[model samples]
Target: MLIRDLPEDVVMEILSRLPVESLMRFKCVNKAWYFLIRNPDFIAKHLFWATSEKRHRGLLLNREHEITRTPWVSLHSNETLEVSRYVDLLQFFPRDVGELVVFGPCNGILCLFGVPADRNGPRDGLVLWNPATRESKALPIIQRPAEMPTTFPFRFGFGLDPKTGDLKVIRILNLNFRRCQVEVYNLSTDSWRVINTSVNPIYRINSPRFPSYLNGVHYWLACERGGPDHWLMLSFDMSNEVFQEIALPSLTERPSFEAVAVINDSVALILAYNDLATRFYYICVMNESGEEKTWTLMFTIGPLLHFTRLIELRDDGFVLLRNKNGWLVLYDPITQEQRELPIYGDSFQVVSYTETLVMLNGSGECA
Candidate 1:
């Protein structure tokens, strides 16, 4: 049946369920769908559902003998359940791209940033891609300063303004030691505007691990340096376009291992340390300081989670990655449990959880 035969609301509902690929393809099916799909509200609705569906979905990249392949896989909700391996897509990536790969997924779109070859060479920028739909938009290149420190690392986040519904890309450049520079690009303006600001001691590029989206802002872990070497918790607010150091709750002693992530719809910091009797773990629930009250300690899981990779799952929960019988296993942190996801054929390094996708090592060629 023609889409026109369906009610307007029904048509939008149907469009929202289809992956981005089907939506883009359906746009060519008729003029009405083309106009409907392009509507900002419809795009927002599709992005909402896509992000929800992607949260539970897991992507695996298997590379062997110099050949790499990445396939999107989904995890069953059951903690101990096993699901069959499936390939959502089977395609080879172009070769000689870059050494470092970072996945910044916003809405249903995944933006890839690559590490630059040298100071004079083209720096890493944004490329929009939809895995579920396999449709992509290669963004224009943005200027990068060549004089920055060579060894320093940078962080990137893709966000949308919930107020004006504008799509933007934010890049935080951390120089050698602890210097930071913030730059924002709006798709509507197609220009890069550097924010005037100075990071206190300097923030280091923490692992791409705990960065997440909530209430239209992207939050990640950064060290706010005070003295020559001391570091504190730093947060980058994407919506209001500001950066501020957070004061963590008072603890007897700071944990040796610290991670920042979003949990239960709130920004949280997980501090872990080893004590003589048992391993100590503490979670600090975050809320705007003056807007509300104080930092609350949620839970404390013992030494069992010493070396686990803690990540916020796509399903609004969390997962712990550990080696099980030489295979990687995922455990849910909240329930204090574990499960095995059958990931095989490791040719290239695969870094992904749910919202953050994976990009294999390759030469610079559009896939």
Candidate 2:
């Protein structure tokens, strides 16, 4: 009647339901259990259960120390929003302020890099990390391909390659010539290669902080180059590495700010307009199941009620908001309850993550 005596499928079902920390320790119990836990199919199933059940969900927070200015990355429980673990990003990069960890949670893999101490310093090495298993793979610094110098920070996104199921890091540099020079780092090959730039859309990937990668595609609120002042959702399919653009809802006047995020496994467009009275957020979710993509307006959160901006959206109807005077708040519309989060620091970075053994020992096929 022991777990080991159970049928293979039954054991897997029971083990998959357990938390990642327990499964990690269970791996050494026996050779058969070790192999079973490491199997790609088993890992994917466990990840599916974790995500669907919302059991191992955590929020990654990137912030700097208020007194020392030291950069730190921590994982907090999604339910409690309390810090569970801390990894100083300074250890990953030599620079003072490491880049925000917003690039991922793609199959529990994150792209980590350094922000130059100033605008002129060189970037440090890039690393792919899985906080769940505490394993990381560091890549060589990608050298700038363009001969012309530019001051813009290299925009990077991390996602799963749908075809190969391998992890990939996308580095995009919008050159002055209105073209994007793209390089992709494939984790399976552990190398970086430049993809063709001729076919890339001329739209500039809008923001560095809030770009979202859901499933096998990366989403960004982009601006078309040399065209009308229309906003577009620029998406790159990781499987084919093809660029596609989805137009946003045309407005009589441009929004003061635009951002994109993945909510409920769909891309959401957020347009914020500041008027004389207060700021308003136009929230829309894009539906792609049809022959052509369509946008649906979801909500219009507004009137600047204490919270100045929307930071995170949860499936359970909780909205994370931020104050203009430095406070993190959460709003539950159903209960009409508002509470401030204990987390603090400047330039806060938050991403939802479901713990998985994807990058255990920094090698495996990601889910």
Cα-based TM-score, every candidate:
0.71, 0.89
Per-residue C-alpha lDDT of model 1 across residues 79-177, encoded as one tens digit per residue: 333442432321312222334343544554455554443445655455655454445555667555676654555666676677765667777776555
Q: Please give, for residues 30-141, the per-residue lDDT of candidate 2 as tens digits.
A: 9998888888889899988987877787778777667767566788887888889887665666566634555777876777776655546655568777778777766877
Please state the error at residue 302 of candidate 2 in Å. 2.2
Cα lDDT, all candidates: 0.54, 0.74
Q: Show the lowest summed lDDT stretch of 10 residues, model 2.
A: 358-367
